[model samples]
Target: MIRVLVVDDDYHVAHAHALSVGRMEGFVVVGEAHTAVEAERLVAEASPDLLLLDMYLPDVTGLDLVRRLAAAGRVVPDFLLVTAARDIDSVRAAMQLGAFYYLVKPFSVAALREQLESYRMWAERLQGTPERGRHVDQDVVDSLYSLRGAPVRRTTVVRTLQPTMARVLEIVTAAPEPISAAEVAEVLGASRPTAQRYLATLVKKRLLDLELTYGSTGRPEHRYLPRRS
Candidate 1:
């Protein structure tokens, strides 16, 4: 079972989130915290796998708490930011900090359930991966990262990929062998990081396969190719 820690400044809201979690299969709320201090203590005691966090806390902000936990070398669990903060900056910050998903406040039970269920399935896929010499192909990685988007397309219209993303996918699909980020960067005349980010995005979208090849440097390098059947 996946243990979860729910943190919110409002006791009633925290209880509501906890109750929602309790109804889900394979998940249990280890504890609920109303402050950063309490949250940290519960984290140390519970060592939960997922944290449902609110941005506003009596002490430090939720993001700061996560940063502190990570910096302190404590158990840093996957986070789902649930807050009334709806600013674009906060959303971008959450994505930058790698929150699994950001959920707005006053969400319905079904809306919350969709995200939670997606996370549960994603977590299961991650936990199911082999431990030794484990390397995930494009499909597995896609299923992991593409968790939330699939539902959208099914319920509505297909979303279009951004130009750079589309180009990255096209380039990878046209490659004869697994292509490195350096090659893609050269072709696009973009910085290596930009190319790498695009490649990573493509891999996550299940449009490209990521293969690691180690050379004389003794460091593994990721190369991308079209997904194989």
Candidate 2:
């Protein structure tokens, strides 16, 4: 399994993210940290394979932490920034620092899963190659960067979701207001979990928007709406 370290200032949010990571196949949350210092220590101790990092930390910025790790000669794991930072400078810095992916805050489970799966594919390909300095062609290099801007082909996992995704998008778009997964399930004659999976997939594709709705009884629930172009 791919071990993951989740870092965020908020304990609740970090724990929630850890839970989500644990739910994903072939991945497990090995540790959680609320500060850059703690995260750095955990990276060294746990030796996680990946990190889900939040940009704004109590001690240092996530980008600065990346730089610090490099400066310290620590073997840095591949990381995806899970941040609320929306500034262009932040995004540019993350790219320059070699973040595997950037995921804005309040993302769905499917969004994180998509990036994880993409990274898994890239990691598998790299591992399959001989480490004795084999020649890598342009196509192999292009595949390594497939998460950025590659044309979708039938063989890719994302392409396989297109057919059912169309139906999910149709249902979400036709709704007058943000709808819950249970409601969608009832409409589509599917189980709640099945409907939730489809809705999360649509959110990951940017075809739907996910929001939180609070009721008097339980934790806030996710509601989905058609994303405005």
Candidate 3:
């Protein structure tokens, strides 16, 4: 299992994030820290495999903590920045400092789950690759860097969708407002179940939002909206 340490200035937020991490498969929350000093201490004590770090800390910035650990020759685990820092400089610094992923605040659980799942795939790939006398090709390097971006295309849903999913996506994008599965089926000339399946796939890809609407009748109906990039 991947041991995780959550660090945030707010005690409640730190605890909440830790709980969320604990709920994910192959991950466990090992510790929580509310300050940079405490985070450093916990890093040394807990020896976590990953750090869910907040950029704005009570004592010092998370970037400073990362640099300090590096300067002190302390082993710093892989870090995923979970903060509201949107400045280009801060993002560049985090990327240069080697953060595995940067998650903006006010994000949904699905977004965080996607990042964790992507990280899992990356770790698995790294572990499975055979060592070749320490030499690496450009493709291997590129694959590693790609984990920091969007969800990997190797996911089963994406791989199975093929060319048809692209057309389904186009129809969804062309709609002016949130559209229902029945509407999509009519537009694509496909069965409702088929359209619903494609819509669910897009939602899982984080490209669409699924909203529930009550019709004052039976169960709530799901409406799909293209997510703003």
Candidate 4:
């Protein structure tokens, strides 16, 4: 099992993250701490395979904690930074200081699972595997670099989709309902015509399933639900 240490100043946040880590099979939560000083002691005592670090701590900044560990000739476990702060400068500094992955707050369980599973696979590859798959090789190398360097700045990747399509996808995925384009537009802050165009795109992408409702109204309205896996 891959041993993990969780460090967060907030007790609830630390416990929640530890619970999430424990839920994944083949992973163990070995320790948790609320302050940078406590985190340093835990890291030394636990010697965890992965450290789920928080950026803010009561005693010191996470970056300074890492620096102090290095200066003290202590062990530095592979790190995954889970932080609420999203400033580019701080993120850049964390990357340079050796964080394997920088996860922003409000991430879903799916996202957390995705990152942890990726790290696990990479760890497996590093343990003297004879031949690594292409995806494994790429993911492992990229993850390492992400830990060591700043992430490239770019506009939101999710916004590349057509506005209506994006809104439709978010809503349907969150709550599946056969919502008309007008309704979707109102909820998503888009024009009715624009919503209609994106709705068609979402249907084309197979992200939404459209159904026509024939009520005694001016026209038959189309509703959409999320396409489940």
Candidate 5:
């Protein structure tokens, strides 16, 4: 089974994530922690395979907890960041840490399950490799890198990114905070409509995430964020 440790400052939200993981197939909630101190204790006791980590914690940030663990030469599990923080720096840091996935907050159970399924497949592949010399071949390495839980029907992978698509991705990934199409247009010297088209495409490609902020008067504004690799 894929053991999971759910960590969030909010008790209710942490319990909700743990319950959701418990209901899934072949996954178990080893423990839930509302603070980094509790999380470190549970990591030693439970030894979970994955962490549904929140960026904001009462003691220290989730990212810092991971860093501290590594610095102390402690065992660290695969991380799946589940947080509301959309800053580019956070995303870059998570990627550098080699997180399996980064899930944005206010997400649905179905969305979470989709990523879990992909993770399960990837983990199974790693666990199932032949033991002769205990080394994976180039094909296995390629498969590991290419598995992003993308749709099974997506086969025509683009080797080179289109100029506009590349620019939109760059702008969002470098942004200090979640930005809107208007901001993107201003940065690219393009029209709002044109910016929206590119942002929508990036979201569809899973290269960026779209968040909605609702207002009392009008429609919810769509904000774009960089998607973690």
Candidate 6:
């Protein structure tokens, strides 16, 4: 399971977010922190695989904590910023400071799951596998750096959606029933519209089958299932 730490000054938010992440498959919440100082201590001791951080803390900025970790030669886990603040400047700074993704407040659990899965895939690739491509080169391994070590994007929507889309193709193809966008959103913590957009892309790619389902109230809901060769 992917070990995670949720850090926030607010007690409720910290626990709630941790619980939300724990509900996802192949994930476990290893710790929670209500202050930057405590967070640093816990991260060092627990050695989490992922850290969900809040921007504002009782003591210092989250970015400062990350910087401190790097300076102290501690293990730098992949970071996902979960904050209410949407300041462009702060967002840019955090990304530049090497946050993997920044999740805005009120995001769905699906978004969180998507990001976690992305991290998992990235980690697995780095851990190496026997069946890896024979032609794989340094650049292929380098691209995986963007997954944990480098900060390429700010918004969780973009950071999470791309990997989630790839996984959705897998899920839909394996599911026995047609999956609706709402189901996809539920699994990934994304908006239904966002899920639908990705689903549409897969359909365009001929990787999914799109159909319309009628609700009991006679409403039409679009559904997608995997297309088999």
The reply for model 1, stretches above 4 Å from the true place, is: 148-229
> Candidate 4 — which pairs collide?
none
Global lDDT for candidate 2?
0.83
Clashes of each: 0, 0, 0, 0, 0, 5
Q: Write the per-residue lDDT of candidate 5 for residues 43-119, one digit (tens) a residue.
A: 99999999989999999999999998898799999888899999999999998997877888888987787777677
Compared with the true structure, the alpha-carbon lDDT of candidate 4 equals 0.76
Per-residue lDDT over 1-229 for candidate 1, one digit per residue giving the tens place of the 0 to 100 score? 9999999999999999999999886799999999999999999999999999999999999999999999999879999999999999999999988898988887888777777777876776687777858888888777678874234332121134677877877787788889999999988889999999988866755567888999999999999988773
List the candidate 6 regions with Cα displacement exceeding 4 Å: 129-229
Taking the tens digit of each residue's C-alpha lDDT, what string does model 3 give over 104-209? 9989887887787777767765765668667778897787667664565544334434587767877888999889999999999999999999888888666688
Off by over 4 Å in 3: 152-229
Lowest summed-lDDT stretch of 10 residues in model 3? 152-161
TM-score of 6: 0.61
Ranking by TM-score: 2, 3, 1, 5, 6, 4
Worst 10 residues of 4 by lDDT: 149-158
lDDT of each: 0.84, 0.83, 0.84, 0.76, 0.84, 0.79
User: Which has the higher TM-score value, candidate number 1 or candidate number 6?
Assistant: 1
Root-mean-square deviation per candidate: 17.1, 9.1, 7.0, 11.8, 14.2, 10.2
Give all TM-scores, in the order shown: 0.64, 0.66, 0.66, 0.58, 0.64, 0.61
lDDT of 2 at 192: 92
**lDDT measured at residue 201 in model 6 versus the true structure, 0 to 100:** 78
